[model samples]
Target: MLVEKNLPLQPFNSFGIAARALRLARIGSEAELQALIRHPDWSADQTFVLGGGSNIVLTGDVRQLVLKVEIPGRRLLRETERGWLVEAGAGERWHDFVAWTLQQGWPGLENLALIPGTVGASPVQNIGAYGVECQDRFDSLDAIDLETGEAFSLNAAQCGFGYRDSVFKHERAADGRGFGLKGRALITRVRFLLPKPWKPVLGYLDLERKMAELGLVDPGAQQIFDMVCAIRRAKLPDPALIGNAGSFFKNPSVTPEQCADIIARDPKVVHYPMPDGSIKLAAGWLIDACGWKGKTVGHAGVYDKQALVLVNRGDAEHPCTGGEVMTLARAIQTSVYERFGIRLEPEPVVL
Candidate 1:
């Protein structure tokens, strides 16, 4: 295992925030990780596992030992009577993996195409788009315990998935009642169970509009993938062109009564009824309603096309700092809360 000191992190993160990793190591295999765990300088509490860096915000120089996961592979693990089990190394680009699965005739992940990140980070965020979430197709994952250097596996239930959250995002309670993995685990491989007799998820408004425009009553998996990519491209700015982490806020869920209250005040409020009876409000609508689109706060600004996205308006020479991004996010959150009485939680992991 080789370690580099004072590594620049501008290229690693999607937000293009100017930051550095004081010390960094690349773990390209399970053996490398285990070896690092046994290193004399190794400290679990002082290390941070970095995947594709698509879902994170680097607030400042990372003092932790940054372990950049570079493990790479993908294959069809097996085929069951009901579905196909596919596996991918943690470092595989999520969008490429989704497209690969579709090319191989698997259809379940089409709706999640074009999402930026690594497979290892997908479960940590329970990454979702349109109407499908990673948890819906997740079979299990293999990980290494940083403290014990022990290999283990966890099924979907063990992951404790919620909206853009999982056990990996939280720390264990003092009494050990909670099953939070947080920084204790490093995901190495992820397995997905793509069901046979696949059905497309077209419930989202953007997707429904695509279907109507194309006059596609029953679109195929590839078609849906194309449409999703197009929709995302039309709405989201490419990280290469404009530094962004896609949607910056999670759609807040409220009680039906709460939705009714908001609707009475603003009849045009965009909301969706969930299967669980809670109502999911469009976070973009809320931010737009608060007049945030195309607004700039310091070097951080809201994307002009999508109010849900927070972008870095500065160039590489004067990149936006993590503080600026968070400041703008906080301001948007405060405005949304003051107007709608609903708190908008940011989707990115602020580190």
Candidate 2:
């Protein structure tokens, strides 16, 4: 394993914010990772595990060593009466992996197609879209303890998957109240459990519209996959063209009474009642209602197409700083809270 110093991070993250890592290492295999933990010079340096860099915002130069996961491979490991069991290395691009699985006739991940990031990062955020969450199809994952240099695995429940959250997002303390893997575990591989007799998930209104437009009562998996991709492409700007993280904030959930209170004032508030007693509010609607869409603050701006996304209006010569992004984000949060009486939580991991 080679360790490089003073590496530029501008190209590593999706936000396209200019930054650098004090030291960086590209890890392609488990053995390489083991070597890193055992290396006398680099082993003890504080480190950060970077996947596809799709879900992170670099505020400034990162002092810690950055481990860029590059593990690669994909295959159907086994099949049971229940479904097909597929395994992909942590480094595989999430969207490409979804396409590969569909090409191989595994259809469960179609709803999540077109999401940016690596397979390893998927479980960390419990990434979801349309109507499916990673927890719904996750089987297990292999991760190495950053502290002990030991390999371990966790199932769905062990992952503690919640809405845009997982155990990996927290930290352990002396009291043991918040026990999270956080920087303590580096994911090496991930496995997916795509069930047998795959069925379509077109419960979302957008998907329903696509099905109706196509005049198909039952759309196949591939059809659904194409539909999701098309919908995302139409609604969300491509990062290569316009630098951005897919969604800027999580769709905040509220109680039924709170929903009624908001609806009483604004009859057009978009919301959906959940399986539980809570109701999920459309964060984008709240932001749009507060009049932040298509507004620019310095180099950071809200995406005109979708209010939920924040974009970088900068390029090589003059780029947007992460602080500006955060400033704009905070302003949006303040406005939404003042108008709706609810706090808006940003979705990206700001570093």
Which candidate should be chosen as best, given TM-score against the real structure? 1
Q: Give TM-scores for every candidate, taking all chains together and pairing residue i with residue i.
A: 0.99, 0.98
lDDT, candidate 1, 245-335, per-residue tens: 8899999999999999999999999999999999999999999999999999989999999999999999857779999999999999999
lDDT for 334 (candidate 1): 97
Candidate 2, after superposition: displacement of residue 44 in Å? 5.6
Candidate 1 Cα misplacement greater than 4 A, ranges? none
Instruction: Encode model 2's per-residue lDDT on 1-351: one tens digit a residue.
Output: 778999898888988999999989998998899888887765433899999999888899998889999999999999998899999999999999999999988889999999999999999999999899999899999999887778999999989999999999988776876668888899999999999878778789889988888897988899999999999999998999999988999999999999999999999999988898899999999999999999999999999989999999987898999998999999999999999999999999999
Candidate 2 stretches with Cα past 4 Å from truth are 43-45, 176-178
For candidate 1, the per-residue lDDT at 253 reads 99
Q: After superposition, how far is residue 82 of candidate 2 from its true place, in Å?
A: 0.4
Lowest summed lDDT window (length 10), candidate 2: 36-45
